[model samples]
Target: MEVTDVNNVKIYNLSCGKTFPDWLPDRKKRQLLKKEPSLKRRIELIQDFEMPQLCNTINLSSNGEYIFACGVYKPTMRCYDLNNLSMKFERCFDSEIIKCKPLSDDYTKLVFMFCDRYVEFHSQSGRYYRLRIPKFGRDLDYHPPNCDLFFVGDTSDIIRLNLEKGQFLNPYQGSSTSFNCCKVNPFHHLLVCGSTDGQVEAWDPRIRERVGSLDCALSALTVDPQGIPAIRSIAFKDGVNLAVGTETGLVLLYDLRANKPYYTKDHMYGLPIKSVVFHQEWVISMDSKVVKIWDRETGKPFTSVQSQYDLNDLCLVPETGMFFLACENQKIQSFFIPSMGPAPKWCSFLDSIVEELEEDQDDAIYDDYKFVTTKDLEEIGLNHLIGTNLLRSYMHGFFIDHRLYNKAKATSNPFAYERYKKKKIAEAMEAASGDRVKLQPKLPKVNQELAKKLYDLELSGDGSRKAKQTVALLKDERFKSLFENEDFQIEQDD
Candidate 1:
């Protein structure tokens, strides 16, 4: 028996639960009858590994071979092989793990940050060392060119450390507010830090000063009534555009050329945005319950999936188009995102109509005006000699009358007359030597005695009060020359 769809087309074989198009050729129909299911799913959850405690953070190696995860409830760090989906190693920590980072692309050495103001260095060769810091470090990032140098951001400043010598380097002051996250621009080698005050500051480590800064609160179109939302997560796209997530669940994409965000999406309502990842042309934002994928170019949400656990961190494998989500429920979930294939049916249809309209427009004929030649002008009925003489006389008379009218008008106004005289003098000077007119410098008109008096007042113990008094005195026309360079004395005398 054949089943018909809503469009009244035969699409299904009810007896065998098979589906085939009515336009299928006999040879293709036989092949379809022998073939297996063609409706294969695109995304599949490969493995979901549960840990002993809730994992709060996760980092993948640059080579995309291993994963490093840490938990707050349990003071332990674990490494897992991405290919085999098995735990490679696990080490117990003295305190709760705040963050973890792989030291190299091979994942041989690892750095772990703890809440007890200590950073631990562990290597595959069974070597380890612990360094105590003054304040609790919130985020850690390694310099792209030099892996031996890493930066840690705390409440008030960012500290640079040398991993080779296990010593601290120069410390760079960041925002007055506490830092919540930090990242290093792989292309520019600049350190970027996000603070609890909703500000992102980019510092050049060589000069150790802030080069650029943007306030997330100011870029928002609508302010969150509660308060200034803190920047919780940040990701870079193309090393120039930055994607920042706020506590109020807003994702803002900032182009380096402009101070404001180029695109803003309210991904979640009230929940804090936990993680943001940029892969290819897709931007993934995760909150407590949902993971949203957005088209980076258009800022339109492509798809959203509901999750059972609260996601903490997300990492994408560049080699394969797969991404991993570290959840608060101690499970790391993997998902495969397929590429954007053919255009949608509606889009293709609209494009076809546009193409047809463009073709129709190309076939249209238009008339453009061309320049008239001398022969055509003569053909219109005037002798060439008489027309040429008449045109020259008309041009000469027009310029002569215009010059006379301007001279008459200038004579009526004293300022205009003086300006006209000066212009004529400049023109004569230029014609004489082909040199531009030079401007004369004015002599300094500052009163030495008044300046000395003001300087002595500022040097006095009551400088603040005397400075206020001096400002008030300078407001008077008689004493204004002490502060201004203008020759007001000549104007007053006139």
Candidate 2:
């Protein structure tokens, strides 16, 4: 199916089964008048949101319920509630905001970076902390599970900060030029940074050392021999593949195991890529001219939408397959893309029922006994084997089936009796076949004196007749024959 935009509406070219009937009214008919479910097309407007200031960066909460945006010109940070489609709060900053990110999963705290080398931290309760750093950070990323720590990339270095202690840690230095972007791979626990020298470097934060690096310049064409294209944006797929965007309007896909980019594409818009987002099967890249979605496997453009204003950032809501773009015109636009595979069944009806029941719970009697599904157990953090079994027994009045109890008891032994039993059986089989060895083979010991002489001669670089005679004495026929005779006698006894 092809989805296109016409007069601010999305026109979907859908296929119905049968053709239209002759009696259909032309004025009342849709774009495709079909009587027997033939091919048809229709227009739809899914969703949209407005912004009060031009947003340079946008971040969505884990639950996809709140949006945090900050930008320059107005230098304001604002939060929007997706459910109500309204602004929650707006806070103005002194310097132009370069980036805004939530400090935690619950969104209780937030971090903002300003163009004037100031980093600000704010909480939901209106408490805030501002720190002046050595240089302006171009990009920032929080530690996956630790809200107290974050990494910021600046010109020539990446710095780590501890918010809880209000202290700066040792800076990770490697980039020869300014860093344009940085990201943390939660799955692999890697810190990645993109530099103006057209290099992407991955660091092992635990060791405080550089682990992997890639030169993005090789992926793009160069006109000036000395000029290096700046890496503008970066995104990762499953912690194994990295997508890098450069100032030369080229997107390079690099496999973490390979030293070079596996795929490269010169963007059709030919503008610097402001942001890149990796969907399940598509790579969504946006810049000043347009937002383009490319087939991830083929590295070909699947679809693109032209924008009148420059796009600053793009975010994807994985749960709904919806994408949001923060633009230069003080607007946030959203679009829905159909999944490449069969869509999963949504539980909206069940969710609505639960919400309704939750609202009137006070009127209902609290039942001591309740039927619990697997999902309920998971929600309450009882999905493990022991927890699940305990919950099952409790819900069933502490009575478990005899067979299941026995199975669980057998499997729960810490010594792993099952493996022990298999090992014993294998040993017995070997004995029955008379294939077991009565004695273990011994490894030959090194000749220390001869080895020392050879080492000394090699280091001395002496190739004289005296050194040759000494080497021949070390390989004396009588001594070699004595060792060989012992080995032959041992093999004969076996």
Candidate 3:
């Protein structure tokens, strides 16, 4: 017994799912109900900016206004404007940036840890100051309460930089265990450091010494005869429970009260666990090979994705499903797991964008012309029209008119109709540009006196009302005329 769909008079497997029917009058209504917002949107949020090569680290500011990313290939740091969905600015450094962190809420104050055993402080405009560290820094975490920065590196000690005093403080020395990463628990005075010797150390910043350590790889299901797996990442769940990711791709959940791990989960791939995040109800771990999410308590597998890119780092907008991954070969990519949490207050439109994506059938955007590869050209029976102006040659393919696909195929001449096709393409471009375009170049409408007044007012940071009044007076219709008005006098130069 077959049942009909909600759509009326179903043609039984019509092309409506792939393309809007030509005879259909209400295409949007058919798609409206199917596009209801759900908690399963996991598509990449495309941002408008140029991406850097080998993005090694990423960080979100305390406020959701900006996102920062660093790439080692060119030793450059890129900041994205989340509010406008565009790039704010990019800065180049002398050495490869191991990690980038924001110290200020709005991303105005930032610190870039470089591989050259030095850290540079960058303000909103440019470099403010720099300090040389003892060892090469791997990662860093900022403690906002005390205005301190905890840095982990190739050494056993956790170096501290007193941001307020602008000097290096006493180091948090631990056993001869090289540290990989450090994270400060927001709910407590505890700071956790993941070591290269498969140990996660707990330190009390007030006492400035080691408190406790959890061995993540001890008594494991499958013991590696070579050596113990290194602890690569650590995330504090609360004041007690902690999440630790290891080099062997295992995530160990620990109860700070006990020595043994409460729950140990594996990613099964022997890759180094680069990041571990504790989202609502689930524990997310990324090991470059894949990203796995599992239940927090029972360790039941929720979902896993094979992100084959060279994932070097991961950053999450805490409390939300939104997280970003940094790759070595590709640009930083962001994913929103709608089921975990709703989009933040600043980016509420993400819900509608995801819903709209559901109604879109084709991956390519609708435009005046569409890119067609060799196979597409063959399928459309226009392979012989390759060299003609009707098919504009681009990278590895040609762009053909989307509306006149049939007409483009009818133009079988590879050479004879070149001049005619060129004229038609030019005409189409002119029509798209419209009549507002002028034939001659024109200058911007800027009055010299108004611009001078505004500039002086900005530099002085005074008299807002005076600047506005000056602009209003300069923009008067009488003064703007070619002939000077009697009310405005111009001094004659000798």
Give me the candidate number with maximum TM-score: 3
Per residue, candidate 3 scores C-alpha lDDT tens digits across 1-494 of 01122212111110012223346668664664367432122222344332545778877887777888888656888888887777888899999888888877876888888888889998988999988998888889988878889989888888988988988888888785688888999898688888887778888887777888877668343544447888888887788888888877778888889988878887878888889888878898998877777899998877664555778777778787667777755446556665667776667776676465446625544467888898978865878888998888889988888876756555644553665666577668768877675454232244444445544544333334765665454456765642244344334452
Candidate 3 achieves a global lDDT of: 0.72
Report the candidate with higher lDDT, 1 versus 2: 2
Q: List model 2 lDDT by residue over 1-494, tens digit each.
A: 23455434342232112333458777546655544233443212222234555777789887667888776565777787766656788788778888888876645788888788888888987648888878777888887544335445556768778665678887788756678888888797788888888888888877778997987776565432345788899998887988999887788888899977777777755678888888777888878788777788888667776656777788767644456677876556655444322211231232343345447655543343344455544444434644444444555333334454445545555456655776677667767967655453332344444445565564344455877766564467756643344442333235
How many angstroms is residue 424 displaced in model 3 relative to the true structure, after the best TM-score fit? 32
Which residue pairs in model 1 clash with each other? none
Q: After superposing candidate 1, which stretches have Cα over 4 Å from the reference?
A: 1-48, 144-154, 221-223, 340-494
Q: Kindly give the number of clashing pairs for every candidate.
A: 0, 7, 0
Better of 1 and 2 by TM-score: 2
Tell me the lDDT of model 3 at 422.
62
Q: How many backbone clashes does candidate 2 have?
A: 7
lDDT of every predicted structure (CA atoms): 0.65, 0.66, 0.72
Q: List the pairs of residues colliding in candidate 3.
A: none
